[model samples]
Target: MFEWLRVFWQGRIFFLARGDQLPRFLNQALKDGVVLYHTQKSERGMRAQIKLADFRCLRRAARQTHTRVHIVAKYGWPFVAARWWRRKGLLTGFVIIAMALTVLSQLVLSISVSGNRNVISSDVLERAEKLGLKTWAYSKNLDLNQIAKALQEQLPDAAWIGIERNGTDIKIKISEKIRPSIPKEAGNLVASHAGLIKEIMVIQGNPQVHEGETVRAGQVLITQALNPSLPSKTTAPNSAVNNAVARGFVRGRVWYSAEKQILLVEDKVEESGRVATGWGIKFGSRVIMVTTQNSPFEQTNKEVTSPFLQPWRNWSFPVEVIRVNYKELHNVHLERSVVEARQLAEQAARTEVQSKITPMVQIVEENVKVLPSNSGAERVRVEVETYEDLAVYANP
Candidate 1:
């Protein structure tokens, strides 16, 4: 008990002493007025603790007695204070911020939203404020995710709604679904892309390019003005074609290319099996405890669900449970050889080029070119040729 008390009052060091003169070493330490406690014999040598104040005197005693000392551990508040005092600024700032958030979290400070084009921001705020999410209201029990979902349902144009909280501020982001566009009607058959004219089966139009001629994008391959001076064999089998909209198939050989760069070094992140679950209660527009707490993991993936029924469709129920689950993630870096990088780049290039062509179109010829690389990435470009219908509306 005295040893423990002495250690608390002052600071102590645990050390091991080795040499043939162990007994002489202790005698000299005591004669030198050095304090020692918890003395015991171990496999290495005699072990003991001395006051940090006596540490310098003990070293002198060891050298005079030809005994070597090895420090095993340090104890007491002085060492602890010294270690933490270096980070005093960071610790003080963290405490101040934490206290400020604690007081502000109980009251609603600000509510702001963005990305709403057709839906007015005031309408969204009005709906949320009515649902118990407003300025100066209790924010401790309000599930922002639920509020976002409810507000999204009220706005017909919104495709998705995401809500985030920063201290006392709540922010809402919205994404609207895209509307389709109507294409103009076909007037004269024109080349859809730059290609070599392969075959033209004109139904009611004048042949503007020969079979071996090259045409630019949007160039008229067939016109409605069927000139009599043009070659008769190029026209479809009929008496004489009228000025009706030109309709027929014009096959052309076109080339499409795509380039992709693959990195030799990559970082892959995955769950590390450590999880933290935070719990909270939601009553009306306030959320408490769980949702207000920060995640424990440095890097984590959060999964949360709200138990409250929203006010969408003119219905309202503001009480529910909330659980925020966090999963820890660890990153693993991988390095690949040049050969592997080139293979990945080629696959990516092929996938990208396929998106530029129609589903039924078959690649007639394919070529791959790789630039010489001495760094960590490989660049590959893939070019493909295809023969398909090149006719499109010749809009003026």
Candidate 2:
């Protein structure tokens, strides 16, 4: 520790000396209270390292002994810092970057949620944010164990939870509870939507309705109770049927409708082709703008591009160059014909229907009609009929 302190303060230098009286020069230098280390002697000359401040004193000793001294190398932090200080711009940039990184290391930049299926990712992130585990939060203030316990208590469906951090990114990993299958006695199959009963196939229950019958929502299409007195060749004498949970598919035709409206006049934004460019330097959270002129357009779209400084393998500088571009935009009013408005409204109605329907449902028929509106907007109504499974399991 003391040797390191000496190097840090006084620095260290390696020098070569060549003279017949080199031995005398070393003796005199030691006598004058100058320390020498890592001394080596070769056929050509001698090399040794001494404190940079002591080297000045050693020069006088070398002159008294008629020996020539030549500086070979310099080592230690002080010497390296001095070399960098000579280049003012490089030194300023490095200092700014170092300070920025030191500050950024304490703040969080991103939070990611993974390993969730039944529980929504947004729900997990919302909970984390409420607990002060979010982007821009102080990393050192977070307690992983406390946060994990809180999440477990809040989210009963989560079987396991883990919080981990790497640099500015935080990751929340969760293992959701696997819901157990419905017990044979606990659940019953029921209609998920009101529709016509196209077909009924009972796998573990008695059919309650016939094909082509219209059923309302929440009505059961199959009964869980089995008939005991019904005689069958497959059943033994005195054997009774058990009341088990119903399991089967009840496919039906379900009708859905969506309405969309489009205005006869609309405003559309178009690029004006006017662009301006500027450059800036970003030091972590602080950005210094180098451009002198303000943007010329009232409405503009801005884009930024930044480049990283990576000088060596596995090492990179924190400083970056930022380039910005601003593009002008103008809003123009457009008039739409009734036919064009109807087409756009129909397209929007179809999209709305697609969002409402699930992947399991197959659309079988569609009907579209354009209606007159008092608001001067073209209204398009779309009706879709689909053949889909209406069976949904529910606890008895």
In model 1, residue pairs whose N, Cα or C atoms come closer than 3 Å (at least 3 residues apart or on different chains), thus clashing, are 140-286, 140-287, 141-286, 141-287, 142-285, 142-286, 142-287
Instruction: Tell me the tens digit of each residue's lDDT in model 1 across 1-396.
Output: 997776677988899999889989999999999978889998899999988998999877788878999999999988988877898998799899999878777787998988877668898889989878898887778888788768765553455678877777878787653322213323566676788878888777677888978887777776665456656676663423423556566777989999999889989999999988888877777878555387888889988776554567877566678887888988978799989999999999999998777544656899999977658899999999998667665443
lDDT of 1: 0.78
lDDT of 2 by residue, 1-396 (tens): 997876777788899989999889989999999999899998878999998778889877888999999899888888887888899998899899999998899999988989877678899889888998988888999997799868865664565688989999988888654343444424566666688998887777778888999997767677665555565556653233434556666789988889999989888898889899888887877778798245768998888887555357876557777777888999988788988999999999999987766533478999998887966589999999998777665433
Model 1: how far residue 55 lies from native, Å: 99
Q: Candidate 1's error at 132, in angstroms?
A: 58
Q: What do the candidate models score in CA lDDT, each in turn?
A: 0.78, 0.79
Backbone clashes under 3 angstroms, per model: 7, 1
TM-score of each: 0.41, 0.41
Q: Pick the candidate with the highest lDDT.
A: 2
